[model samples]
Target: MLRVASVLSFFAGLVAVTIWIATALVEHAVERDASRRSLEWAEFAVWHVPRIDDLAQGLPSDPAELAAFEDLAHFGGVFRFKIFSPDGVLRFVSDDPGSVGSSLGTHNEHAVAVLTSGEAMTFVKDGREKPDRPDLYSETYLPVYDGDRLVAIAETYMDQTTKVAAVRTEYAIVGAALAGMILLALLIPSGSLWVMFRRLRRTNAELEEAQVRAQASDKSKSEFISTVSHELRTPLTSIKGALAMLESGKFAELDGSAKRLLEMALKNAEVLHLLVDDLLDFGKLATGGLEIRPCATDIAGLVQDEVDRIDSYDADRQVECRYTGERGPLFAHADPARIAQVVRNLLSNALKFSPVGGKVFVSVRERCGAIRVEVKDFGCGIPPCDQERIFEKFTQIDSSNTRQHSGAGLGLAISKEIVEAHDGRIGVTSAPGRGSAFYIDLPFCEGAAEAGAVELRNVA
Candidate 1:
């Protein structure tokens, strides 16, 4: 508001200054032309009037001379005319006979200016003080020269009220136009800015509403997952227990195709249980309920344990598993169970993607004051574009319906959540065909640093 007021004030000042200058120039020109015309008339009277030299000798009694003086007084809007001798005596008065033969003072300013400069002099006088006249008058004085000899001075007074009115009217019209243009220049952009401000306010309101709705939808989805996971886990637990009993020969003896069918049922039930657990974990993570219990633990031992477990479980695949890194213990502040889960997930992915007889390598070491673990596999690697989003919930590299892989695709996502809860980071480096290497980095515990047992080593 202050800025707008300042702009208006500046524009008004500019207009006022422009009008003042223009009016001054026009008035000067008008006054100059008036002075020139008045002087011309004075010169004409001096040329045609009979013998002003005789008037200095005495008052003119000739009727023709007196008539000429009267005609000069009334001509061309002239109000009064007077003739002065070189010695400052008023020789003749055209309108006022009473002032004839009066001796003006030697210091009469107008007479002295005309005689010395030989130039016309003009001035204005207000007649408002007189009872009989109420108008402005312009007076001019010029010296009459009879062939390089100063003879007398002629003075004329002319009414100028009409010309003054015309100049004032012209100034008013031009000033109004310039003021209108300045107002228009300021108003147009101010109007556009006001409209844009309103639109921005409306857009901000819509965005706030959309954000509220999105948050509500996300809460509803998390509740639904939590409820469904709890319901499925109860039945899945019973089915898994029954399958375990049958596989253990506690319910019946199984052989041949019957034994194979029992094993398949047990495997599928376990997979279902794992899926239910994944769903529950996802819900807990979304609701900020997933937490880590950190303790000092040997990272190398954890990796070795997960590798041994995977080897025993997937013995039929005949895949090679190797652990090579720091021979000494690498300890970090982390949740042991959660760290184990993360390692297992990485190892499981490596095995799943590897060909039968392909190698899976697990390594653990200290790097940059932190414990680092890497699980690498010689398998079909991930595309560069897909690597970034591979750890998101339910995202699978091979997502086609007929793809040669199976699972709920929540392992990597769950692992990422658990690792982050322990203040660690997990990522993968891969290409189309070379292979994939998944790594975890965790901060070292104070105890591990004090123990002075941590060392950096290269993985074979």
Candidate 2:
């Protein structure tokens, strides 16, 4: 949860920073454009003022020029112009419709600056004194000259405070937006991570409690099994001794029925002994008490020995064992005795499932940086779904009440444990009514590089 929060916060902060920079850059660009346009318009008004003055001076100073000036003044709102003769006499007044003749002097700084310097001037003017007029305006004054002499002055006022104010407002809005974005980026991911951490902490607490309960339950189960096994061993020993004595005729000669009963009793005793041994072995394996001593053992030879043992087990069926591949000693890093035990278990399982005169093939090969051993049998194969579960303790593929084979069902489970202790993997492949192949793959401890080089190009 902390990890997730850190990543999200980093991304959010990055996005916020990017947005802030982009907004600042865009606002700067807008302000630059606005300033450029405003300066261009000011320059245009200043340069064009001379043309207006020339038209007024050349034309006749009669009702025609006066009427024409009046018409231009009314059409151009908020614009006022004053035209004077060379003797400083007012020739035209655009603001007054009736006044045709008037005298003007340098009474205002705006008009004085333009007339004296014969240059354009710009200034801001307040419109409060003129209530019927708009407020907050900028004025551009242009001087009209005939040759080297000043003729008149033209002034134009444009409303522009609103545009300046809009730019200011946009800047303020962007600042506020940047602040809001930063807050959201920090707050949202942090709050979510807080909630996630709370839930995970709760889940971890529950898991700890469950572990405690499982440990206590397991302790109780182990104690109970140990106590029961001790009590059963005493009776089993007595029963075995009495059955052996009767078989030897220590008390009296037994009839056919009596002898048969003794043999049955001995068989059952042996079965009980096997069950106890399997239980003990399972306990040791579970508690990590089982030990293995590994060496470079001839895996093929070990497999053959186990196969020979299987052959000794008398049955009407002939279970043939065959070895394939390079017969030269195929060595593997494993306990010879344990390896043989695992082989014996697989062979026994195969024999039980095979029909009369069925064949069991054992093959050993060094390949893929490991020693591969496979035991295949032409027997009633396990179901596909049951193949994985068959390695589990007490799990039998054939669960019918009248199943032909019987055992404690711990052989394959123990075999798997032993194989894995040597850093190996065991698996089975089977299909119904076809056959089953049980295999073990163990890492080679020595000469692996040589073995691998030789086997690299050997495809199987």
Candidate 3:
């Protein structure tokens, strides 16, 4: 509203200035042309009238000259005409014969100037001062020169009310046209601004509505994941327990082929269990319900344990795991279970992507006040573009139906959440076909071994 008011005020001021300047220029031009025409008429009348020499001696008695002067004064919009002698004596009067031979006084400036300089002068009279002639008149004083000799001055007064009225009519017409143009100029932009304002309002309303819907949808999705994970847990737990019993020699009498089949079943069941667990963790993380239980833990021991576990799981594929870097205990304040989970996920990925007889290197060290663990494999590495997005839930580099990998692709996502919950960061560095290295950095906790007893002495 304030903006609209300001724009209107500005345009109003501009239109007023334009009209004032235009009117002033028009009035000046009209008045100047009128004065010139009045002077021309006065000069013509002076030429036709009795000679200035004759007027200097006495008023002309010629009927033709007197009649000509009378015609001009009466019908040519000329209010009056008079001839003054060089001595400032009024020699002739066209309107009033009785005013002839009168003394206009020696101090008459108009008559004195014309008689002395032999030049013309023109001016307007105030209408209020002439009761008989209420309209304004343009008076011209012209010197009638007798071949370079001073004679007399002829003064003529032309009524200017008609010319002024015509100029005023023209001004009225021009003012109306200019007003219309100014109004149009103001309205066009105003209308466009109003329309734009309306669109902005509508866009904001729609965006707000969409945000509400998106929030609701997100809540519903989290709830669904939480409920489904809970339901699948019961079945998954039973299947794993049954598979463990079978593998624990309860089926020792079974044939070799049957035993191998049972082992494969157990492996696949474990994978499914891990997927269900991942979903539950992701749902908790999404809803801000995930909790981190931090305690003084040996970071090197955790990485070694996870590396050994993954190596054993992939033993059939001839994959090997090697531990390097600082051999001494590197302590950090972290949730042991969550940190172990992150390490296990990285080791699993490295082993899965490695070829037969490939080696996975696990490194643990302390650098820059932080405990750093890295899992590197010389396998077909991730593309640079896909590396960043691989940790997103349900995203995978190989998503085609015929891809070699299994599972729902939530391992890295859950690992990322678990590491961050413990105030740590996890990331990957890789290039296509070169290799991949996944690293985790956690703030080092000094004097951790003295604060807590060693959880596991030998991680191998």
Q: lDDT values of the candidates? A: 0.79, 0.69, 0.79
Taking all chains together, each candidate's TM-score versus the true structure is 0.63, 0.58, 0.64
Question: What are the per-model C-alpha RMSD values against the true structure?
Answer: 7.8, 10.8, 7.5
Per-residue lDDT of candidate 3, residues 61-118 (tens digit): 6776667667767545667777677665667777764452335323367878777676
Q: Whose TM-score is higher: candidate 1's or candidate 3's? A: 3
Please list all clashing residue pairs in model 1, or write none if there are none.
none
Score candidate 2 by TM-score against the native: 0.58
Worst 10 residues of 2 by lDDT: 99-108
Q: What tens-digit string does per-residue lDDT give for candidate 2 at 57-128? A: 444445665565655433323345455443333445567635533343324455566676755565555676
For candidate 3, give the lDDT of residue 52. Answer: 45
Model 2 error, position 66 (Å)? 22
User: Residues 167-192, candidate 1, lDDT per residue (tens digit)?
Assistant: 77787787778767977987899789
- For model 3, what is the error of residue 3's alpha carbon versus the real structure, in angstroms, after optimal superposition? 5.3
Error of 1 at 318 (Å): 2.2
TM-score for candidate 1: 0.63
Steric clashes per prediction: 0, 0, 0
Could you tell me the lDDT of residue 404 within candidate 2? 81
Ranking by lDDT: 1, 3, 2
Worst 10 residues of 3 by lDDT: 98-107
